[model samples]
Target chain A: MTQNPQITPEWIAVDCSATQMRATAMGAAGPLAQATGETSKDLEAALLCLIAPWLSAQTTPVIACGWDAAPFRAVPCMPADAATLVDIPTEDARISLRIAPGLSQTNPADMMCGEETVIAGALALNPDFDGVICLPGLHSRWVHVSAKEVVSFQTFLTGELFSLLSQPDDTLDGFDPTAFEAALSETLSRPEKLGAKLFSLRAEVALMGLSPRAARSGLVGLLIGTELAAAKPYWLGQPIILIGAPGQCDHYAHALRQQGITPATLDAGDCALAGLSKLRGLL
Target chain B: MTQNPQITPEWIAVDCSATQMRATAMGAAGPLAQATGETSKDLEAALLCLIAPWLSAQTTPVIACGWDAAPFRAVPCMPADAATLVDIPTEDARISLRIAPGLSQTNPADMMCGEETVIAGALALNPDFDGVICLPGLHSRWVHVSAKEVVSFQTFLTGELFSLLSQPDDTLDGFDPTAFEAALSETLSRPEKLGAKLFSLRAEVALMGLSPRAARSGLVGLLIGTELAAAKPYWLGQPIILIGAPGQCDHYAHALRQQGITPATLDAGDCALAGLSKLRGLL
Candidate 1:
């Protein structure tokens, strides 16, 4: 019997947000080891704790992306052709850390902190893929990429609203697809009715004893339906790709399919690591 | 100058919600004395405390309108024409308490616990006033009262959403009317973009250092603009009445005036009392 030897990573990539931070060890092929932790008051200490095992005596390049970057501290106006990186001077000389700059738009006055990396990675994967990319998360971003340059983008607070509305440990039991589709369709056609429709969840529960799964699906459908209507111009006749966790992407894919559009899915973590990889080349 | 003599009332009108309870002493003309208190575990005790000075030896009728009633416990299905009142069956023999029933709709599965009293009061003010009545509160209600009957109504979680988004004790300092009108117009035209427009409030604050007053007005404008878009059917070409606290009603009126509608304003507490006064006549 024989055992294959282990391979070491060339660098490390970390994506930190207000709520969570994820670190991935990058190898030549892809991600090797990954760690995640809840964002704490001391994020740097938390990041070091998660990636300590991967840190070595040698000065290894570690690229970080998310809210910690300079671009994210304020409203950043990065041009479509802008590819800038900000180095985070670390206390330990052995660890070389740099953060990727996020993208911002002026007209709508919108900004994105973390999802820019995923868009970068998606763009890297398909250099010629010029279309709209949907990244679902706490603050979902719908980005428009053309000619290998990131153009304007919009951010939707769909995931944040859902989290605020649902219980911490809430989980869907037996999701009803019919309910979800119906809500999605109705909301898409009449997005303005959202302010009134949201409370119906409580009404249904109080009156008909709506199941947890049905309620969960209904909430998600309403949020996504409203998002789709706003982002209609972006996905009207463009190739669309969704990047997020499997569950999040599944919901988005289902909603888009209901609108007669088929979108390809990409792993969020991999895209983040891949985006950091692309930024590594620029650095 | 001679002082007007104090007048005693025959009955008391109370409006109780999940958060607070308001009581009004009804004289022959209108409300004479008003009292309010935060809702506690013992609601009946709280109600007694609020109206203790007004309690008389006689079985003074206390007409209550709020979540304390049976229909509010769960999803109530009271028809538009169903103006039923339930007795509170108080332990106090000197108190005769009865609660006004709320209105519920079936198609959209909507229900209101406290605002029905305001609608009833508005109808009582003008029996032939066949138009829409906008009740602004935590769950703002847009009610249709045709021929003194509640044909249908809708509820928007505008106030609730604003509370969740704002900090506690947050006050708008020097509210910018121009900014609010601009946002209201923009959102009314593009209501679906609300999900995206909301996050920009945070971005503008971070990037541009937006004033709290402007930000507050923007949030209010976005919410009310969306509500107006949904309730357009109710207020368009109709004689509208705004029923709520002065501050809330002012905002509704300002928004309506932007659309060239001058809605008559009515004090919510007085209207609740007046509604109870009308119900007392029937009893």
Candidate 2:
């Protein structure tokens, strides 16, 4: 049998956000040929400049584009609205571009935000993952991906809520995060009087004059406990995979393990890169 | 025999929320003419109807405008700032008024909410009250009233927080509230292992197929515990006066008593009304 000829494909990955845009170029072998990132409020200019460098490298047939966020892209339509690709301009600035369908939920019409793409990308790296995936930060997302698709997800207002609760205003402020982390660790160990401990924030202030930091720590503990309560039903008996900040992941992992749930975390960027690489051909 | 002339003062009580206005014609001997009440959203209109009959009957200066919400009476220098009034129009259309402010802080900028009216009202009934007054609800307010003025207060998003944590959208729909209340009562009986019980929402769903209602109840317990933690600082071994829902007050009373804080609950409306009545002259 004659061996099939090798074909090099030009590809681009556009990761868009409210504040910035990141774009990457990849070869057929999934290696980054060139990368561009820009911080701008306007995504249109960012996207145009992001893919401009890759166009001159090689004029390959059927250029593939891996796009995320609300940035525009085009592809051919398939049956039942699946893979329904639209048209893209074939100008020098606007070459071939493709968009992958991020996780979409109807009924309420809620969709994941920027960080979720990275999370979805992470899950794409491990197709066999069958558990809870926690993306921790100010606005943490817990996405459930199974059987080649994102099944359901929930967002915990952990970071922002903590900020608001800890710092009611300028006069009031938060204490060291270590105190919060320590309280979290201790609360997880017992996991019994967690609520009582949470309620103690105001009590501590009233009784012991808990500084803004301590009050903030108390709030952090309470929010974490509340989030755990919310996530329990969805993640019961399932292993947890965390992405995002290392310290936050460690805290959550410690908390989860104390509660007898297995937890594992990986770097967010690596997952996105791996996911973008694998989907290069399709893009 | 010589006797000081008895002075009866005319009084008006305005409940903006309920859209009810009341006026009592008085003399030094106490209420001389009939007191009247009318239902109206317009404060001026309601007041006219309530006091018009009394005004026609006799000529007496309106000693004071006792109103619950700040909008009922407009005094230029009394409050100094309208923004400082704690109780205002609620979201509900049916309730046409807000809670009024009691005493002002020396800081000028420092002022408490209308719930201060309740504490004042409670004190009007029990002037020697020296403890924590917990106004539990969606926006739980904890006030430490000392020497007839509110010394300190804090707000807790306990009820709203609980709803967000347990119910979380329409996912846990069609939940029976009765069963949840029972479970909540059971949880309240033993405050030692509340954290475990709080987390048990997920456990129950997994192990026993807990219904949405049961999960909601678990959330309430968690909120109570969290609220307790926040209020603990201000407790200062003072008695807890629950000024909201009777059932909730009883639950909190039981919880606080277990934690070694004495608790007493009064009629929520009575406190609100009395608070409004006491502030009638100021408004």
- List, residue by residue over B53-114, the lDDT tens digit for candidate 1: 77667787888887545764222322212247787788877788888666666667778877
Instruction: Give each prediction's DockQ, rounded to 2 decimals.
Output: 0.66, 0.05
Q: Which number leads on lDDT?
A: 1
True lDDT of residue A192, candidate 1: 94
Proportion of the native interface contacts kept in model 2: 0.03
Give each model a TM-score.
0.90, 0.49
In terms of TM-score, the best-performing candidate is 1
**Please, what are the lDDT tens digits per residue for candidate 1 over residues A1-283?**
1122353468888987778899887887778877888888876788777777776678878888874548652233322122467777888776788777666667678887777787777777877787889989888888887777667788888898888777679754566887788778877999998888888776777667777788788888888899999999988888999998888889899999887899999998777777778887765
Per-residue lDDT tens digits for candidate 2, residues A1-283, read 1222242236565655444455655565565544456556544455656555445545432222233433221111110122433334445443555444444333212344444446556666676777668877766667676654556666655665555445455464334656666666554443434434444555565445567666665566555655675567656787678887676676577567656777778986666555555455343
Error of 2 at B84 (Å): 24
